[model samples]
Target: MNKKTDLRVLRTNQSIRKAFYELIQEKGYEAITIQDIADRAMINRNTFYLHYQDKPDLLDRCVEELLEEIKNAIVQCPISMRPFSISTLETVMQTILEHISHNTSYYQAMLVGENKIYLFQSKMEKIIKDKLNEGWTSSQGKSTLKISKELLLEYLVSAFMGVIIWWIKNDLPLPVEEVSSQFSKIVAYGHFKAAGIAVEE
Candidate 1:
């Protein structure tokens, strides 16, 4: 009976989440209401309130959960093995791409359309920035950087998000490996493309 109860709760949560994502994709966040979610999830308003304080709370929790997964994926990138290596960056990007592939709807709802949540983007960038900075602190050779660490990292994160959004909007036109590899190349060899400057590997 306890197991059945737990399974029911889990199922309800999944239903609510699925309904929320579908609604966000269909009508945008601002227009959604408690009744809308409950209707879509086939649950009562009281049930919705039992799980979340309100729509904002639901959005917060959903974003938090998804971002936590992204943080975990970043942690799995083996930054310690080669903190600033192109391969490490590629691995991290590919990991993120693969993870997003598993939850495309959530990302699409939060990031891809006119009604997308900018707050999600802002929060995600901060997480990525924090992780990259953490990696930089643990690694060496930062003394050789010609630009401020903050500026360089900000640039990298912006470009990183740009590539991701582009991929998501395009319905993932390129394979994850190829996109990650090209991204790394752009990061490591962008100056080469802009000018004749050769970047040492």
Candidate 2:
């Protein structure tokens, strides 16, 4: 009986999430109401209330689920192995790009629409920053850059977020692997190197 109840709950939540995503795509986040979501999901308003307090709460839950999915993908990628080298970075980018590509429509609705919901982006930044810090701390070799660790993390996170937003906004013109490769190359080789600036290490 407990197992059956859990299954029913899972199905209901999935329905609500699916309905919310569809509504966001059709009417945008700001314009979507709890009643609209309930209607689309074919559930009562009270059922929706039982699952979520309001629209923002529903959005938060959806974003949280996406974050978990991305984290899992990153963990499964070869990038999580060891030795934070250029290859590892490229793999990380590839994993992220693939995840984004897989959920392009949902990401487009949440991130690329005219009324973009920045909360999701902010949450992603937090997740990336935490993971980067963890990886750096646990890696065998530490970076010898003159910059502070915090500053480096901020730079990397900003660059990653910028690339993701750009890719989504442009409707992902280039393939995911190609974009990941280019981004990894740019990061691995500094702008000065690409610009013909000779700086001695």
Candidate 3:
């Protein structure tokens, strides 16, 4: 039946992707081949070809699929970004962290080690930057910002990415809410305030 055929196709695609991700972590992306993927997936090279044109195609799809999920989640967050509220940062980050928790292995393979795919990291940062950029407006009526929008955005995105990598690299030490809250606090206040260090008045 056509239904059964579609189900089979779905299962096979899952297998292929799972194999590709595992191999990325174990062997590094540059070292993996279609045959390696097929063997790890327990499928033949022909099956891999049926789903993807080549290894590059498979890698592209894997990155695209994950990034698309992130984009979708970001789009769903209704928080405003201008002025950089703690609640806004927490909400958006919580959404992303929750989503990442569901697929830690894929992220680990793409982001955690020497084997990490820089392309995935770059694309993911771009997604975050684009989302953050969407919330900023020129401070026409408000007080002028001491920092440039570009610089602030860069800091937020880099720090966000660093925390995420640290979270995964350390096996997610803190719960999502706690991590987001801490990150939000540090951003809204200074690190000294977030850490309870008394500032010299």
Candidate 4:
């Protein structure tokens, strides 16, 4: 589409998403409806439907946008910030921590209960797979590595999500950088240990 049309579509989608996010925060996924979103955005139900089939579709789109940005953040590691380094882990954690911190209002609205846990699982699964791929090789054979990788990925993602949820539920009294620094060390180093890789202190 032309630039003007693109901008219009973007603006409309943002309005709808902002409305949905606010309502979800005040209530929950189950309580939200297309009419509520339309009312909040001051748009007609037809306008809302033009962008999304329903509330869940809107949520999926929102989550997809968040994940795409997150993936870019992770993959665009600087040359000085190689993923193998502790400092690199800290950097990655810091980027995500900042995202979470900056969007505290949005997260504070929806990131609790099942929603929080779901976000954690969905976001970390790719990271876990990457880490697994990095450390595993053909020497371990496909079958063994496949099973081990899956199990490890599941465990680490669940553990990381659990920790974050606990921190959030406790009101996030600690500074995010501190919490994320410790998390990077604990998670990345712990993975090194699990994979029998030597850590340089």
Candidate 5:
């Protein structure tokens, strides 16, 4: 497509997405309808359907974009940084923080509503799994289910999600860097144990 055509499509999709997001913030996902999104976007139901198959499809696309942004951030991260290091964790935190910051109202609504929580958590889980896979390669006989690497990564991801939820609920009192540094230390200890780099005294 030509640049103008591409821009128009992007602009239309963004408008529809924004309307849905606003509806979600106001009455939540369960109450939101295609008509509501179309009304808010000043577009007809046909336009909404043209851009997205359904509400869930739109949400899935939104989360996919977020995940892609996260992957890109990690890929662009400095190679000198150690995995699960404080610096590395900050990079992760920065991505989350930026997203939350950018969509504070939307996230706040999601946090307050019961329906969106599962979707948010699942998205976070996928991001963690992707990042863990990026950081570790599997060896022969080392199935992800039975390996310490996977176990530790799962634990760390769970912890990170918990902290993120808490931070968002609490209005993010501390700096993201400070909170993530502490999380990194906790995760680093786990990584050390998993990788046989440290022995318990």
Candidate 6:
């Protein structure tokens, strides 16, 4: 049946992805080949070709899948719980943190010796920007923020990405909830207060 075939294909793809991750960790991405992946995945080169055009295609799909998962998590977060509230932000942050934590090894591997940081940062910025645009548009002109939407998106994305990279590099010393809470506070209340910076009225 078509359903059974789909299931089998799914399993094959998962196996290939898992193998690719393991190989990347062990041998690095530049050193990996399709044959190597197929050997590790217990599939033939022809089977690998059937599923993916090449190793780069596989990597692209892997990153795309991660982005899709993150986007879905953000989209599914319940806005009605408390729209634009720190609690809601914390929930969203927690979802993101949990995803990163769950795939720590993969992230670590991807982030090293490459410009992959931009890949993640840009994708996250787009997702957050889209979400914020939705919120702003739905606010019925009641939202009053002095900053441009583009700048706000860049600032948020950069800040979050910096923290995430630092956390990952340090092996995530703090718990996800604690980090999320701290990040939410920093976003809700500017860091100038914590740093004792006086603002000119």
Best by lDDT: 3
Tell me each candidate's TM-score: 0.89, 0.77, 0.94, 0.66, 0.69, 0.76
Q: What is each predicted model's overall lDDT from 0 to 1?
A: 0.87, 0.80, 0.90, 0.65, 0.69, 0.76
Number of the candidate with higher lDDT, 1 or 2: 1
lDDT of 2 by residue, 1-201 (tens): 999999999999988988887888788888998889989999999999999989888888888889899888887544331445777667777788888998887787777766666888888888777766777666666577567878888988898888888998898989988887777777778767855689997
Off by over 4 Å in 6: 1-11, 23-31, 78-84, 112-120, 192-201
lDDT per residue as tens, model 5, 1-201: 699998987898988877876787678788888889889988899878888889889888877776566566556543222223556666776667766766666566555455454676677677766665555552233343554766767776787777777887788887876777766666656656644676768
Of candidate 3, the 10-residue stretch with the lowest lDDT total is 136-145
Residue by residue across 1-201, what tens digits does model 6's lDDT show? 999999999999989988887787678777889988999899999999999999888888888888888888788775421246877668877888899899887677665435243565567667766765565565655546676776876686677777777787789999999998888788878878644678888
By TM-score, how accurate is candidate 1?
A: 0.89
- All candidates in order of lDDT, best leading: 3, 1, 2, 6, 5, 4
Write down the RMSD of all candidates, one decimal each. 3.4, 4.1, 1.7, 6.4, 5.9, 3.8
Q: Candidate 3 vs candidate 4: which has greater TM-score?
A: 3
Model 2 regions lying over 4 Å from their true place: 1-15, 25-28, 42-47, 76-84, 140-143, 192-201
Stretches of candidate 4 exceeding 4 Å from the true structure: 1-8, 78-85, 108-110, 114-120, 126-152, 167-172, 187-201
**How big is the positional error of residue 27 in model 2, measured in Å on the Cα after superposition?**
4.5
lDDT of 3 at 63: 95
